[model samples]
Target: MQLTDRQNNIIAIVKNNEPISSQNIAKELGLSRTAIRSDLSLLTMLELLDAKPKVGYYLKKGKKLTNIDDLLEKPVSEFMSSPVSVEENQSIYDTTIKLFMEDVGTVFVTDTEEELTGIISRKDLLKMSIGHGNLKKTPVSLAMTRMPNIISVKKNEKFIDVLEKIVDNEIDSLPVIDNKKIVGRVSKTILLQTIMNIAKKF
Candidate 1:
């Protein structure tokens, strides 16, 4: 889980002071002592910190670091990437050009309300191009891989779980779905980028 900005500031205080009370933290940050109680509770809950009744909060530096996989057992919400999408009723010709302009391997298709309905891949467009179809008259709804056929990830799914789905299915990316609506995307490229970022810490 990613730390909130306020939580980070609390950690910084505990780190620098070695053992700081919630009251002192509130005083330093100009917040009420009660305001920081939940922050301390959350830090403790995540195992980044520990506290005693009188001595106050301290970083859990003596504890062993989590296993790599455990460290990465976070939600896709932490590593979500902006998605590329097009409306389902759009002309296939315009959608094809937009696909190239967006420079994505696959573009999600949405209804007039911008709710995800399907997807159109470059391969799909290529096949259509070779068929000598009338682009201006063809609707993307006809060419798209429609609803119920779309493979998508969820906001709360473990990040690695999403990556596994991508590799096992041999797909380029999966849209991040939340309560049946598309919110973001996770591509193979984005997954690689995340791995590289984590590698830098060691």
Candidate 2:
């Protein structure tokens, strides 16, 4: 079961103050007791918390905290967005325009056959621009990080694995490859949004 952020916060409060009252929990969260009434009820129904007459809620003994393992194990294909790509030979000026138009932090670079070849980041373009390079005359290839060094994820890869790659590499996004072709792209924003959406559902 996936616990919403509020639910997790409630759990922490109860853990630290086992005899905490609903009023106190709401106060810690800057919400009214009525506002969190449903959350408290749900947690109780889930057996994660217990209530006593004239007392407040408390963590149920031996009950495990909620986990998002199922959500994290979801495939990348379910959350990846359409990739914003540029041809290897496309001019830096054009690529920069496309990047802004799409509002993406990174863009995939492809060859004539549309095969993935490299990746260009906003930082890369910024560095080149600051150096007074002629953007219109420079090919995106000159500003891209070429393959053999690029970190990519497969379509069926788990979200947890993709997150690890992004964090370890300090990258903003990754291209999703299938059959050696770029099918989609995954980014920190997408993953975060996925979690936020799930929280909203509950």
Candidate with top TM-score is 2
**TM-score to true structure, per model:** 0.63, 0.71
Alpha carbon lDDT of each predicted model: 0.84, 0.91
Candidate 2 C-alpha lDDT tens digits along 1-202: 6679999899999999888889899999999999999999999998989999778788888766435688799999999999999999899999999999999999999998889999999999998899888999999999899998999999889999999999999999999999878999999999889887766653
Superposed model 1: Cα runs more than 4 Å off: 1-67
- RMSD to truth, every model: 8.7, 9.3
lDDT of 1 by residue, 1-202 (tens): 4568999899888889878888898888899988988988988987888998899888998552333575368799888888888887788889888978988878899987778999888888888878877988898888888889889988889877987899898888799988777899888888888887776653
Candidate closest to the true structure, highest lDDT: 2
Report the lDDT of model 2 for residue 67. 56
lDDT score for candidate 1 against the true structure: 0.84
